[model samples]
Target chain A: MEDRFEVSILLDFYGTLLTDKQIDIMNMYFNEDLSLGEIAEINETSRQAIHDSIKRCYKQLKNHEDKLKLKEKYLNKKTEKENLMKELSKVESIDNDLLEYIDKKLELIINI
Target chain B: MEDRFEVSILLDFYGTLLTDKQIDIMNMYFNEDLSLGEIAEINETSRQAIHDSIKRCYKQLKNHEDKLKLKEKYLNKKTEKENLMKELSKVESIDNDLLEYIDKKLELIINI
Candidate 1:
């Protein structure tokens, strides 16, 4: 049950939960497109520190994902919700019963 | 310019470029939170195939990011656009000059 989550969940969670500096570096390097040297310069840290912070953040993110599986669950629910939305969107006309069914499905998606 | 792009750009592009089967496996395992075993059973492929596909996808994504730098540029531009929008939204009153400035900024954002 727990072993089924994606590797990126760890990465995302780690990115979210780490120190602001670490998150900044990760976002800059991974999300923002900054080089290690540039990040080091901006943050006034060494390139090695930036590199080590990234590696550590990666490990932590992976470990958390492996243990918690929250990101995986969230992603699965998101994908399911998206698919349901696509299906609903494709229906040009909806009977009352179908609309009610879709409303219930949407409720489930929103709650998740 | 090239070295500054985030790592995930590569991943996203690779995910887009791969075979449907490979993409499906990736979305299920990484994006959809399916287990390797579960994905294997659904796809009727071996666990090793799933593992290898993920690894290969990761490599390709990284290579593309390193080579093209498209993702990084896109992200930086996106972040800047978001910030500009945020700034524009915070203004309670807009004079003609300010409105014109914002319109130009919006046009740039839209074109990007």
Candidate 2:
């Protein structure tokens, strides 16, 4: 399940970078939770065709993830930033200067 | 971008649910860095058809993500598990009984 999320990240990236039909199919299955039969009906294609496309897409997305490793790095940075934000939020009191500094840092992190 | 990773996760999930053609286009674009013209040439389709399919796919994927929120929860749990693992790994030494317990817990997390 955890790995699935990682895979999801890869897929989303792939969708954006790839062709429209790929994105459409991805959205239909993942977003709509449609069965292969249902998707085929909608797309006017066969279930086997849909299944093959999905499997191939998964492989390609995973391959990209393995090569780039961008998703892992991004997740790590996001986790760190979230933790820092939590810490900052828990602080009961802060000097005005420190508060300003933290706010600035947070803004930058959030923007990223 | 940070948001892009989250989107990627959604796309990957969508791809799994979609048709074979969808997956093929996704792999061609995201994994192979193929342009729309190239993709159309390979698929023996019109560029406009590819464009429409991709745009529609993005919209549908985002819609699913917005409604389901599964990706967000998964990411949070994963981040927490990773932190716990890090803490456990940092311990200098452990008593036999405690080590057994920690190891058990770590094993469960890794399996998840």
Q: Enumerate the candidates' DockQ scores in order.
A: 0.02, 0.03
Cα error of candidate 1 at position A52, Å = 47
Candidate 2 chain A, run of 10 with poorest lDDT: A103-112
Q: Where is the poorest 10-residue window by lDDT in model 1 chain B?
A: B1-10
Shift in Å, residue B54, candidate 1: 0.7
lDDT by residue (B1-112, candidate 1, tens digit) is: 1121333345454444566776676677665677888988997889888778777766766665564444554565456545544554555543455445544543343232
Candidate 1 lDDT tens digits, A4-93: 133334545444456777777767777667788999999898999988887787777666556444465456645655554455455554
TM-score of chain A of each: 0.63, 0.71
Mark the regions of model 1 whose C-alpha exceeds 4 Å error after superposition: A1-112, B1-14, B86-112
